[model samples]
Target: MEPMIWRQAEQALAGLLAARFTKDIIRKAEERMRADVHGTLPRWISAWQRLPQTGSLDLEATRQTSAVVVSNAEPIDLEPLTRLLMEFHPWRKGPFEIFGTRIDTEWRSDWKWNRMAEKLEFRGKKILDVGCGNGYYGWKMLAEGADFVLGCDPFLLYVMQFEVFRKYAPQPHRHFVLPLGDTDLPDRMQCFDLCLSMGVLYHRSGPIDHLQKMHGTLKPGGQLLLETLVIESDQPAVLVPKGRYAKMRNVWFIPSVAMLEIWLERTGFEDIRILDVSTTTEEEQRRTPWMTFESLADFLDPQDPRKTVEGYPAPRRAMLLAVARK
Candidate 1:
C-alpha cells in the first residue's frame, strides 16, 4: 500500500472541483508521474484509493512472505530527517538532544535514570569518551562531577574540535586526547568508570574486535554505555549489496540486537539492556523521497517500536543503546 500521507494528499487532490479541468489534462498528469519519474505516482494513487475500503490489507502479515528481498538502497543524509524531527515533534528531555542529534526521550527508560545520574555523579570516576565526536557527551559527564574525563577519537578532525572545547570551556580534570586506534593508548592501562561508545561501532569492519580493545581499557566492573544502529529480527543476516558501506571501505556492519547481546556476553559483560530508538523525521521524509530502496519510509517513524522497511520486510533499521557491566 502507499504511504498514508501521500494517500491523503492524493485524496485531497481527487476531491477538488475539476470542472475547469479535462480528461486530457488528467491523462497527461498521470503519464508524467509514471514515465521515468523516480517513484511511480500513478501506482501510489491506485494503492491509496484502494486502501480504505479493502477487505484486509494486512500489512504486517504481508511482511513475512518468502519472496521478500531486503532493499539495498543507501540512506539519504540523516541530518535532514533528524532536523525535521527536532523541529516538529520535540523528543522530551530524558534522552533528548545530543548537541543537535535527536535520540530517545530517556537514554535508559528501563534502567533507573537516578542510577545513571549516580554513576555520572561519582566524585572521582574516570571516564573515557570513545569515538567522542566533539566530546559533547564527555563535557556533559565532566560537568556532572566526574573526577576525570578523557575524550578520544581516531579522527584528527574531531580531535581538533575537542581542543577548541578545552580552550573555551576548560575544566580542571577534564581533558581531550587523541588516539589513532587501539594501539595508540598510553602505556599504563587506565580503567574508566564509564565509557561512552556511541555512534562508532557501525562504521567498523570488525566491530567487536575494536570493542574488545575498548573493553580492555576499562577496569573490571566498569560500565560501557553504547549506542549504534542495529537490526531487530532473530534471523542471521547478510550485508546489502552495493550498500552504503561500499562508499566507505572501513564501514563494515550494523549488528542486530541479539547479536550485540551475544557479543557482550562473550566479551564478559553482564546486565545488558537494549533501548529502542529512532533517528528520523517527517520533513526529512519529504526532502529526500528517494531514500527508500523498497518503500522504507515507514521504518523512520519514531513511535513504532518495530523497525522494518515497507515491501522489503526485513528488520532493517533501529538504534540500539545498551549498557553492560564489564
Candidate 2:
C-alpha cells in the first residue's frame, strides 16, 4: 500500500507555509513518519484502512454544531465502526461523533473553545496550532472560517486519531496534524496570522524560550492565544515542582497569571489580556469510555479537592490573548 502518513499534510503545507520553511518541515515530518518503530502502528494502520468511506457528507453542518459530526444519509453498521475507532484509544481532546457513535474524549475541549471563541475571529486567517491534540480545535477553527490550519503535536497517537477523522472528512486538505512539536517548526518563519500554544507551556522546561519561538513564528501584528496552568497569586510567583504536580511527571513551571503576562511582554508580545482563568473541574475532564486512563479526578486529593495529591494547588488554567510586536 502507498504511504498513508503525512502525505496529505505534506501536500497541504506546500501551499500554506512559506517556501523557505515548507520543504524543511515536510522533510523532517516525512523522516519521522518513516522512522516510526511503534508496535501499535501497524494495528492502527489496519484499522484506518477498514473504516467505511462516507461519500461527500455535508461538511457545512459541522460548522454550526459543537461536535465534529459526520453522518451518511443512509444508516451504516456502527458496531464494527466503533470497534475500529477503539483501536486508537485514549482520545484526549475531543467529543467527536462519527456516524452515530459518540467518542466522548477525556477533555471537553469544546468548553475551552466556547470560552475563547467569542473573543477571537478566525475568518480567512492562517493559523498555527502548537500541541494540537488530535486536531480537534483545528476543525472548530475551520468551522469559524479559518482559511487553513496547520497543527503539530509530538504524540504519534494523536496524529493517528486525526487521521481517523481526515479519512472521512470531505475536505481533508484544509486541516492537518503532523507528528511534531513547536521545536520542530522552522526558525523565524514569520508566516502565520494566528499562533496557538494552549496547554503546552508548563510542560516546557524553558517556558520563556517557548514563548519567544511562538513570537517568532507569527507575522507582525499577528495574534497569539496562549493557555497554560497558572498558580493564583497577587504577586508574581511560580511553582517549580520538585516532583509531579497533579500526578503529571512532565509539568515544570506553573506560573502566576501576572508572571505569564510578563513572559509574554518579554517575548515581544503586546496588548496582553488575560481572557479567562478557570479552575479545571471533573465535569470538564474525567475518565470516559473513550479515554479509560486516569484523569483529573484521580490526580486531586480525595480529602481536599482544592489541592493536588502532591499538595500543590490543583490545575487552574488561564487563557491569554496578545499580539506579536515587530
Tens digits of per-residue lDDT for model 1, 1-326: 22232233233333321322223323333333342552433433332343212132111221232111112133334465354333322222123222233344312321223324433344567777677654545555554556666666665434433432343343232444443444344332435666767667777677767677667666777777776665546754534324433133344566667777777777657777554444433322222221223222434334452433222223233433334453
Off by over 4 Å in 1: 1-123, 171-173, 186-190, 235-242, 245-249, 282-326
Best candidate according to TM-score: 2
Q: Number of clashes in every candidate structure?
A: 3, 0
Please give me the total number of clashing residue pairs in predicted model 2.
Answer: 0
Please, what is the whole-model Cα lDDT of each candidate in the order they appear? 0.44, 0.86
TM-score against truth, every candidate: 0.50, 0.96
Candidate 2 local lDDT, 1-326, one digit each (tens): 13754567667777766766887887777666653566777788788888886733334765676678777777879899889999999888888888877889999998998999999999999999999989988988887889899899988789888888877666656887877888998878788999999999999998998999999889999999999999999888999998999989999999999899899999999999989999999999999999999999999999999999999999999999999997
